[model samples]
Target: KMSKEKIDLLKLMGANVILTRSDVSRGHPDYYLDMAERLSQQRGLFYTNQFANNANIEAHYRTTGPELWQQTEGRINAFVCGVGTGGTLTGVGRYLKEQSPDIEMVLADPEGSLLADKVNGLSAKLPGSWLVEGIGEDFVPDNCDLSIADHAFTVSDQDAFMYTQALFSRELILAGTSTGVLLTAALRYCQQQTEPKVVVTLACDTGYRYLSKAFNHQWLERHHLTGDLEGL
Candidate 1:
């Protein structure tokens, strides 16, 4: 469901985009892992294995984490996000924890991902499918440090999509699919809190990247996901 807008945006930014095809209709990090492995073995290509790259963590630690601290005026009680490379959670979580160990680093995982189960100290679920993109994994990435997360929330695809549409209706912000998953978890957590807390989650990417699928009403019906639109 890669939209032309996102591809064009990346090209405009001078990102050397290499297009590839996959048989998967659901999300796949293993596919990326396989590609990375192949590219690594090729002499001319240098592979920056994102899953294990410390730089990913450092980037978030130096920039994203500090910005959040400053933006919230040091009053942030929780940091919630989806785990893609695990870089954001690990890097940002580490930085925030160093500032205040009591700060909660929360994980928002799609239903089929093993991350939530891993975080909650429960047995992992059998591999399955979820429609959300950019985050969720069947295998743990080396870059992710689960020790930093204090809480984990698992969201289903239907709920995630509904929340995504709701976000547009309510905030006039068209965020990506994973953002919906993260926000759904964050909102659920916020509602369960006994006292008020300053919580934050990332708008992971642009909804413009998923126009053909998530934003299409017909796509939802075809996928049998329309029932939960107003239900969840």
Candidate 2:
């Protein structure tokens, strides 16, 4: 997709180039890094911005906490989120802590992700595998601060997909798989709370991007993602 877009842009500028997508790059992280390097070398331009650091995490966390607080009329007492870039969790956790020292920050992780175990101070091991993308990681990112998370829940891909679909159907709000994981974690937290605490979680991205994958039963069946759809 990026290659196609780049080629179109160049064509608009009256430049001719041949570009091809390569599978030699492994994983999203490596692919992004390789693309950046290639673009810099080809265009004599380099990005000045920091790539993988904690600053973005902190900023996002701060924004999320305040927004939740305001949205819930300052009654929010807990938060649940999944970490991809880690900016959202770290930043929001910090902000929530500052606003109300007792607010609990919960990390929702996809099954087989290292984050939940890491946050709980468990021994690091090889991350398990899950179908859910974005929220699960083979390794903990630098921006994720486990210290801020009071608890963590590892959700299965099946659960994530079903919950997200149900959320859209029932609430009329389309959200991504990560959001479903977060919402499930939040509900668990809410159930455990003794009082009526306002718990919050992010909607993350829209669900449309996943329509061809999670939302389509045909796609799900083709990929064997259809087991126990009701559980999600």
Candidate 3:
């Protein structure tokens, strides 16, 4: 896990990194709570569960919400985003809803994720996997308030990766794969709108971290992404 090795390096710099079992899909949020409980019983574990933590949400409420409000001059008609920890959406959604309850908060979900189903009140399907990292879930995190989302869009892996590459070429922004999913959904939301509206989504991470996967042609081919995109 070269990506997580960065967290290990942080440990060397006195950042306490608690090693947990690999929970790939976020299918069961309980696994993390159980892990925390088990570890707490064994040792002096200070579990800062960011998933349900108010502080995590408040940080964005205070910082991101105000900044977006000011930057957009309060003309933000819509906010779309993918969920990793659910903090950003929860915080920003809370703030925006407070400002104007009429504002749209749309959830940009990966096709394989059950979250969109949850938000839309559809029956859950068998969970699947996607190439986009740091978003999509098999189970809703505690911080995910689906009421915030006026609508949801389920993006395919191909669509997500295609938009990711497009961002690199079109905007010169090497955005992460999850950001692509969000942006794709956001664009779709924009197109479907009846009136002129200001829609916003975020570039969640740098694409430099994904150079060996999403940015690699061989990896794309292996995953059948480029082929799928060509068909699209």
Strongest candidate by TM-score: 1
Sorted by TM-score (best first), the order is: 1, 3, 2
Per-prediction TM-score to the true structure, in the order listed: 0.88, 0.78, 0.85
Candidate 2: Cα lDDT at 140: 58
**Candidate 1 regions with alpha-carbon error over 4 angstroms:** 1-30, 227-232
- lDDT for 154 in candidate 2 is 82
| lDDT values for all models | 0.85, 0.74, 0.81
lDDT tens digits by residue: candidate 1, 1-232: 3556677889999877766543442245446567667767877778888889899999999999999999999999999998989999999999999899989999999998889999899975675777787889877889999988999999998888888888887788999889989999999999889999999998888888887777889988897666544454
lDDT by residue (tens digit), candidate 3, 63-127: 99888888999999999998777888889999998999989999999988888888888987987
Give the CA lDDT, 0 to 100, for residue 100 in model 1.
Answer: 95
Candidate 2 C-alpha lDDT tens digits along 110-203: 8888889888888988776676656766655667677889999888777787788888878989877778888888887777888787777878
Look at candidate 1 and give me any clashing residue pairs. none
Candidate rank order under lDDT? 1, 3, 2
Off by over 4 Å in 3: 1-33, 227-232
Superior candidate under lDDT, 1 versus 3: 1
Clash pairs (backbone) in predicted model 2: 57-87, 61-91, 61-92, 62-91, 162-232, 163-232
Highest lDDT, which number? 1
TM-score of 1: 0.88
